[model samples]
Target chain A: MKRLMNRRPNRASKIFLGLLPFIIILLVYASASSQRLAENADDKLLPSFSSMADAINRMAFQEDKRTGQYLFWTDTWSSLKRLLTAVFFAAVIALSLGILLGVIPYLHANFSPLITVISLIPPMAILPILFIVFGLGELSKVVLIGIGITPFITRDLLARVLEIPQEQLIKAQTLGANTWLVITRIVFPQVCPRLIDALRLSLGAAWLFLIASEAIAADGGLGYRIFLVRRYLAMDVIIPYVVWVTFLAFMTDYLLRKFSKFAFPWYYQASNKA
Target chain B: MSILLEIKNVWKQYGDAVVLEQLSKCVSAGEFVTIVGASGCGKTTFLNMLLGTESYSKGKILLDGKPLPSEPSQDRGVVFQRYSAFPHLTVLRNTMLGAELSASPFLGIVFNRRKFSAIREKAEKMLESVGLSHALNSYPHELSGGMQQRLSIAQALMKQPRMLLLDEPFGALDPGTRSDMHKLILALWKETGITIFMVTHDIEEGFYLGTRLWVFDKVRFDPHNAEAYGAQITYDIDVDQSAKRRLKKELELELEKSEQAFGASE
Candidate 1:
């Protein structure tokens, strides 16, 4: 019965379910704000109008009322889009660099200490230098996150690559495996899952740095938008942006972990036994 | 009978200490020869010599009428006390590697499903011979000690080597598994018709496994002790002198005891 119930969701169902909750939430908030406006406008025309919701709804839409109330939502989307793009680019560049640095023997050995020491320093410690050199632009922001994320992923993967057993190497050797075959067929497969875990860990750091990235110099990201709203002392927009960034970060982290679980089930399953 | 593999007055040393001193032995093809002794008697050194891995300080050795080479090859398969296989590779791949190398170009070509299928089929046949057909896809770490050793045996036989050298192969296994493995090995040797040379300290293990067994004295002897004695080395001279005489006397006593014991046991 469980197997029968496990029929995969259709593409249409997946899209609908994906968009359903956000659409409903947007409608609810927009309607609540819209209704509040209608009630307040009518209250001004009449006398003896008293509802505690008027104060709360006015507070909710306070920042949105600055321009067209819908601009608030658009600004939030634009900010998320900018940061997600930064994250996407950072993740791609960082994972590639990480895999390369992690696998190369000379690079891993020679620069591992430097990489360890580099990851230890806080992102902001270098943020000022990065801002000075790259001048608080988009380049500096993305590059900063990429630089920070690369070592985190690569070092973890290098440690994992080192941990594959000597017996495994001997087994390959006695079996007549060539050096390249041993690395590709044996080492790669064994380390691939661990690399995935390291990549996921780097993704979390990338999100963190992306927010801190807007701290450098940016017209609009979740970070910049948070600071922008802070000027007006509007906690409402800031709170929502915080919530959205948290949700996005959680979703990405959760999905990567889930994908790894599905892709390399043996790795985690076997380890969890002991 | 023609000599198949011969170790002629071979000497092996581990650092300053000699393990095998001018040891000589010959094993014809299809013969089963076992070396028996107490621990550290250099029986394993003899097996290593046949496998062409251990270097001797002096003398010559031959395998199948050829001078033993510098390096051991797939022509000789060795099963050690511990199973040796890549923990990453599946058993089928492990077995296939032994057979595939040193053959025709057909052997070198992998990833061709047809060729791999054939080698895999042969590997399966070998695994079944050793009762490990169920573990074809399993890695080394997944196997039990006995199963791993069986896999090691199967792995060695995959190449159909001219000789198989086992150095206390079943020593690490439990008694029940050891007995089972011994029987299985004997059956394998009988079926395969390859020469078998093994070293074992366990008397019953040596007895049960080898068709021809050579027992070494429990203590190694040095004849030059008396010639080198000095005032400072007086105790060494006395101990070596007494030890030498005692060893000869002990051998005589042991021979008498063995004969009597054999007569009684029979």
Candidate 2:
């Protein structure tokens, strides 16, 4: 406690220091926006704070005349639902496949080379193919996110599973665990935290795929709204939408980190020592 | 002193390179047998075969006058030098793993909640026996080196196995901690009457801890034919050194190079 108190800056001050850069960016943007609006009241390049607020209020508070629904909440719900569905299925598939490949050499030899080949292919390069194969719909978008991130997540988790020491496996066997028992009881628990870690890393790519597919073709989503507003030079709506997406991604990553720490406290403490 | 394990001229070879040749030993129930050997002298390999993780090229190992299972079983428990306790589990959970595995090998302890308290109670008793009752919820990494080893030993003993295997169990501990562990092992042995087969690189530790000690080394090695030789029991001694002539004869047999016990290779 003494050492913590004796530090140059306290924890609260440190947090404030961390927020300084964000404050500076906001100030610079506000100045640039005000100056542009003063120069030309019709300037759409840098929308004023009032105009951005007006746009958000229209999208969030007022229902659209044509659709009879709030665009902001509808877009957020759709995008989040699609993203979560894709990530959930990808995590499930990757967890099982990674555990099997890591434990059984025969399965690893048969499938790992194929997984490696697939992982090397750029996910963006196959976007057109996904649309072509699955067509321009929800299926294609979700599949795009799954295909974009599944192999990488699987590979990450497979490496983690393989990193489990030989001694632990042998010990489990000595305790009368069969092959299935070892995989489920011994290997599965240890791999769960790694799965969350892999999912957290692949979230960025998952969001990128979601936005790209939505931009290409979507009726309603944050990405679609951004692209739709681009024609009218509605910088207010576009910038807010972008910021919202970033906030959602940040929240997801934070939640996953917190969940892993909560569920597997031992993992965090053990890894901290390492 | 009933025979608990019998090895009949066991020979282990990998392809054409021999690792152990014509090795045999009889271990009785409730006896502490310490094996001291140089590095690369097949000590770990022999232990692996005993644990049923590795296959022998020829001969057989019988436990309780029956052929031992080809794979590891609940009858024999092992404590490795490192990674003895699962870092992801608490001390109590690690100790309960054996009973949990045996009870429900399909689902594991997580879904076996009906018997969890029983297992936890047993594990707590074992931890108390090993002087780690206060660390029940502590992860393996949170404990000191000596404490970790003690937790591991407690984990192995919780199963009540007929035989226990220790592979360089105290090689990484400091002298002070090692001495404490030595007392713990002796006490546990006296209380449980479980046969212990330990392999160590410390000659003094082997002599001090065992009722019987065996030194493994290459009896014949040709420099030109590097793969021609294999390890065998070079010296076997009963810890009872009352016979002065035999004690001196055994003491003169490469005991001066005890310091090289950890360094000398095949």
Candidate 3:
């Protein structure tokens, strides 16, 4: 049989490659837990997979006595809503302002310095300020995420917009496109996929802000649940919650990548050239 | 034929550096004019001035005996060396852009069923004429150099401008592709009878395509104050008498003699 020089691995092998790391981590944890349990039959730090699985099942499927709602599902929903809302607002604002700054010289000259200054300020430093101004409710948490990630998104998108070739702009003008027309037909389409990419890069910061806010004051969120479990030395709940948050973040990033690829195949095609 | 474009005693300067001085030329209706010059000879500067994108320091450009506007207009369509077609649009959409833009409102082009079909039909016809019917769905980057140039020409002509400006439009193509482009351009010129003003460094291309060829170079340069001088029209030949085959040698001799006489070896 003839074999290609750079053949791709089969799907089964690829899946196994992806799962290899998690399997290693689980085996290591299980071995450590067994060693600890053999010495002292009451070790909480390294609970076995069965105990962790049981804890997740009860949290996800069983109703809580106090709230009469599945805490895990409720926490996931609340955290997702805040993160998505903040991310949505940040994307819209950044795309609009970034493109405006990039296209119009006058606006750029006037506003770029201010945006740069604001971007330089660390977002975490303002978490307390956000809570004070917006109150310790959902508004504060969402706004914290927005403030935390908007600057990064705006700067990234601004660079992308600026990177568009001067020839394209002049060509658009020669095609009888006015300022507004150029923005809509040329700049708008090119910047959209870049905005999605910028959003994906900023998602990590978004999650960080969401978790920090929830850990500080929220009653129902993934971060809040993790911190609450920490006080009781409930390592099982803490570890499972952390894993679930990671899984959710990974899914969001994956879906966004797929969406951008499907939405702007031309952009991807040009970029992926050899 | 009446004069369609007249440039009278035009002078251009950039800060203290003079680029063009007392440049006077005119193109009659339906005439094809090709401009050739060495680098830094203000050929592109003159072309931009004609397009009305760059403001001349001192002069008036009259189109149809009326002063041309100071900004780009649909009356003049320009095709650059490359990057002419919008990268994001497919070949068909690139051609359709002009018609759709003129038909649609200022804010945006409303894509109605009837207008869209009509515009599509017109664009398809133009694409077919330019020999890009098979690449209707291909993006600009997907096409070869020759195909991209053809698509850009189609895109420019779709607007039905009175004058087409070509700035080294085929400079980047290989020799074979360049000759094919020459044929395409001549056919389009003869068919439409639209006026053309092309700037090129290729001396042969300028002579082959132009009915009236203009040679531009810096006639007056000071070694100490070089920036004070600017290029002028050194030769304006009516190529109707020079047969296409013989023109190359004849012009080569002419250019060599002029270079020796003026000590402008470049």
Candidate 4:
């Protein structure tokens, strides 16, 4: 039975990657809240920004310069923090679930209509229900982020999954391998190109969602800072934030592309173009 | 030799289109049997039934004594015509997949490096035997068609299966490569006393590889296909030919006589 059971649990970078959000969240929080380490700002961190919009507003302003919109580089770094968190989380979830569903046809079929409906709903449409259900928490925003980004990510993953050469599966089975081995040993590895593509896709959507999210919510975050400056029409601050988001997203994409190239050197010659 | 593998009264159909009818064959241990038939004559269907891929409407296939499952495991390894090895994994991994797939699933996760390091070493040695050692880290796309088939053979053999099932493993290769692979398979058979069940359309290939060959010349009396394989066609030839073509004529006559001796259509 054990032979039948026990797929490799998450290990290596996959485990590090799976927990990355929590780590990065803490890192960003510590760094951003460091200058505001006064007991007052520290206490407010948990209570503030119940949702994506609330978080953005926190970055915008609230009479305190420590946590509020600042002159130049500070605002840039604050906005970069918000963008990176959203992008990294969005990219990971989308690529993971999207590729999973995309590669497994039965999963794709079972969730196909629901995924379509999920996509049709505006990316930000779920926040109201999110607020009611989760009651002003990060769950709503995170789930929303996952859903919003997954559609495009899933589409890309499905394309990549389909791109896997059928011959490989046939060959594995011919060699006396059961079904699961084919997925782990063959389909999964072969789908790296699509996984990379899906990561890039979700990353782009995450940035867009982050902006929209910060637009409506309550507290501190890069999006909130942008809206803060929006009242003052501070295009200068917005310019830096926009420039940094673009740069960060580009960096995420460039880094992932490089990683995929190095990790799966065989993808360079894949007959199936994803 | 206890009929190492047996196909009994096999009939197959894809939907309403019938592909095989009452086909039966018995292969002995340490024997190489090749099936030859015209296009759509159920040659592959017979092979599929033996390997337990396609179902037989009314037949039972036995390996040793137990019934063959829906998917045959370890008992048979097939080499497909296309480049079927996973390109993402190296040739070593591909060959090792046979052994890897059969081991405890946890073994794949725990002690992975240890498991793979050993399997990989064994696979590299198998590749060396097949003349594909240089492709140890190379992907299937990196190797030539002949090399891929050899890798496929190595993969099949890694499991140490009792029989190797080849579905035109070399059909996609060039003429030279095809013969080369045939020689490799033959040599491997001589080295290991395993049975080989191969399918081929190349007439010369069948003669070269098979100990006992069956040819479907559309000459059999098929009660189901009266209008199609209908009455057999008989050809008239001058047995006494001019001296100009004597040698080739004798060879052709000998071939025809053997075909008749093996129950060819009148």
Candidate 5:
């Protein structure tokens, strides 16, 4: 007889095991919703699935009477635009600054402590300051997300650059590479894949900062709509918006991982120990 | 042959701990110099100095009577024991890296298609010479240890360097692969007539591969403070065929006694 710890599930059983908890949670929610609805027809806490479905259709398919726009699509588009713009700028800054700090001792000595201090400072604590300086507009939201994740990503990329074996750098120099050449030829290509990985890890934090900023001050965004509906206790709309945001985050991570594997196959090969 | 390199009383120290002291030697052109020593005897430090990756505390090194550059340059090539090849590059790209860097100093890339193809062709020839033609498109991680070393050798040779520094290049290979690599390296050395400096832990390998064998040892040991003294070149023996045959037995016995002493100290 195999011990419990030694027992391994096959592929089909593993999939079944993974879905068991989600299924149980959904069942629990359905029963609770039915019980609450039985007592009061206007229970706002956990609206029945049908009401949530109607809410989704109204928000996504029907045009708003006031704005004459499909709220769901407009909010998603504006949110994604801000998030992607912030992330793009953050990635560029992280790669260039990370490589500079890692390779040059003079820069490292001067700036490493400063980066460490910046990373230690809570990004959320500076939100009000950002809003005041950049104004309560798209710029503030974008800057919030950028500031929230750039230091972390830069630190991650700097560690990756430093983790490169000293032998490789020496070999590059022996191969007639000057400092700039080494950065472009050896360090840049190697760090690009790691930069993708860092971006994937920081995406969750980026979304958090984006939502917090949008909830405070935004004309149109997913977070703005959620916060706006919260005033009326509209859990149906909020729940769907939260799930959509999660799905979008998952898709971004999945795409970035796939792109890294495709563009830098050697990185995966080396890291996988194949 | 004229002296290609001269070391004038070079000393290397890291703060209070001295590594090498008063090392002076002249290496002629086309000489195969193999260095053997006990662990922590500064042999790798000496090799790093020759490779220009480490700076000595005193004295100087001259290449063709000119002061050797403090930093590594194209005239010298080095292959470390492991991780000599870039993990991100295919074998062909790794081999072409030196040529591309030399051709485009700033960019380290050949933008012209015809020029890029010429570099690629030269890289293919270099890889073929090292018997890695089939694995040109493969990443370094895909190759076995022996094949990786061969790729490193090919990469080092791409610049047509005048001096080749190999730091225990075959140390990580199995016995069978090590022997094969020995034959390959000896053939390459014979054909290219490049000056070679190799550091190895195996005395027998030193005797077999080198025209001159250098032994580094500590003459003075401080019981209270180990860093008080540094290692020096204690023995420099010419390795002719007759001397190799005669001295091999003596060195093996000496190595055994030293190993026993080292074990007892532990």
Candidate 6:
């Protein structure tokens, strides 16, 4: 018989182990909700699973009395639009700036310190300033998300570009590559997969900035809906919304990971060895 | 024979520390010149100077009686012991990269199907010559050390460079693979008649592969400060095939003694 320290779980046991905690949490929540409901039927803090289901149906399936809009779907659509647009803009800006700073010695010398300083500043501290300048509309929310993640992603990508082997660059130059050709053929291709990785890592921060801006000022969004229902103690709706947001974030990260593997198989292979 | 490259009293220094001092040599076209030296003898630095990646502190390196460019150009191709091949590119793409860069200087890609195929065909032939034809689509990381070195050679040869610089290219390989690489390099050298400058730690490899062998050693020594003096080409011997076997034993003993003396000086 193997000692406990030496013992390792098989594939099936590993899967079971992973799910055990989630199952326990769910069971505890269900028991607490039942007990609270038994003590006081009017309890709103820990709503029953059935009531949460009912809230989802109302928000998603049923039309809102005032706007005649399916509140849940509208909130999801608007939030996704802002998030995707901001992310796209951030990615383009970060990639361009990162590559420029990484490749050109003068630009790197001048801008790297500035970028580092910007990254050090807490993005949320400038939330009020962003809202005032860009207004309380969609622009402000998008800008907040863009500003929040751009510096981090840019720094990450810049480091990746710098990490490229010097010999490879010399090799490229020897192969008849000029500066432009070296960047495009060698540096750009190598930095792309790393850009994807940087974006994936920054997604959590992006979402935080998005939700904070939306909660502070927005016509309709997942964060807006969740915060608005707090007055009525609508835990049923809030809980479901939070779970949905988590699922969306997870799905985005999953898709990005899959896409990176598909598009840059070589990068993944090299990283796996390292 | 025409002199392809000439070094006229070249010196390389970083800050106050000298790496190579007053190095002078003239290399003819199609000659295989192998360099052997102790570690930190500035052999790699000298190679980098010829490749135009490193600037000389003084004097000049002339190619075809003209001052060599301060930056690397297509006329010279280089292969390091590692990181010579791009990890992200497949074997075929790596080979095709040189031609592609020349074809589309700005973009470094060939968008036209016919042009792309032509480059691809050329790359395939180069890979076949290097014996890496079967692993065309495999990335560099997937390759064994010898195979990666083969790929590096194929990639370098793709440009049809007039001069090839190899910096300890087979240092990482096993003995069997190193011997195999030796055959491949000699065959390529004979067929293409490209002037070769190879740096090796193994003195035997230098004698075996080169038409001429150079030994780099520092003459002046400062016991208190190691950086006070830099290495110079101390010995240059012409190695004809007939005389190589006879010269090997004597040269090996002499170099060993000198190497021991160099260590003692330090």
Q: Ignoring the other chain, what TM-score does chain B have in each prediction?
A: 0.79, 0.90, 0.92, 0.80, 0.94, 0.94
- Chain A vs native chain A, TM-score per candidate: 0.64, 0.95, 0.93, 0.64, 0.97, 0.97
Model 1 lDDT per residue over A1-274, tens place:
4687787789999999999999997677667655766778543212121332343345345554555454445545655565556556654554444444555567667877887887787876788888889886777777677677766765676667667654444344444444455555556666766765766667767767777777557865667777775675555555556667787777877887788777765566557622
In order of DockQ, best first, we have: 6, 5, 2, 3, 4, 1
- Which candidate comes out best when scored by TM-score? 6
B204-238 in candidate 2: lDDT tens per residue? 78878898888787778676665676788877778
RMSD over all Cα atoms, model 4:
13.4
Task: Please provide TM-scores, in order, for all candidate models, with all chains considered together.
Answer: 0.60, 0.93, 0.93, 0.74, 0.96, 0.97
Q: Tell me the lDDT of model 5 at B114.
A: 95
Where is model 3 chain A poorest over a 10-residue stretch in terms of lDDT?
A: A166-175
Q: What DockQ score does model 5 reach against the true complex?
A: 0.86
Q: Taking the tens digit of each residue's C-alpha lDDT, what string does model 4 give over B1-266?
A: 76787667666666655556555666678888776655555667777767667788777777886677666566777777776677766888777877777664532322467876887788888999999877688888888889988888888899888788888888888988878887899899999888987888665676677775665434544555432331111211222234224433444454465455335322
In terms of lDDT, the poorest run of 10 residues in model 2 chain A is A1-10
Model 2 spans with C-alpha error above 4 angstroms: A1-13, B110-114, B243-266
Candidate 6 Cα errors over 4 Å, as ranges = A3-5, B223-225, B257-266
Tens-place lDDT digits, model 6, residues B1-266? 99999999999899989889989999999999999888777898899888988899999889999999998898899999999999889999999999999999768889999999999999999999999999999999999999999999998998888899999999999999999999999999999999999999998899999999998888888878888788999888898876688877877887787678667755
| Per-candidate count of clashing residue pairs (backbone under 3 Å) | 1, 0, 0, 16, 0, 0
Instruction: List the pairs of residues colliding in candidate 1.
Output: A171-B86
lDDT of each: 0.65, 0.88, 0.87, 0.66, 0.92, 0.92
lDDT of 5 by residue, B1-266 (tens): 99999999998999998889989999999999999887777899899888888899999999999999988888899999999999888999999999999999879999999999999999999899899999989999999999999999999999889899999999999999999999999999998999999999999899989999998877777767777778888778998999988888877776666555434433
On residues B1-266, what C-alpha lDDT tens digit does candidate 1 reach at each position? Answer: 67887778766665665555655666778878766654444566666666665677777888877887655665677787763664545777777765554332332437667877888889899999999888788866778899988888888888777888888888888899999998999999999998888877665565566666666542333344321211110011112334445544454465455445334432
Model 3 misplacement above 4 A: A1-18, B241-266
Docking class of 3: medium
Error of 2 at A19 (Å): 1.4
Once fitted onto the true fold, the runs of candidate 1 whose alpha carbons sit more than 4 angstroms away are A1-124, A127-143, B1-110, B135-143, B161-169, B194-203, B211-266
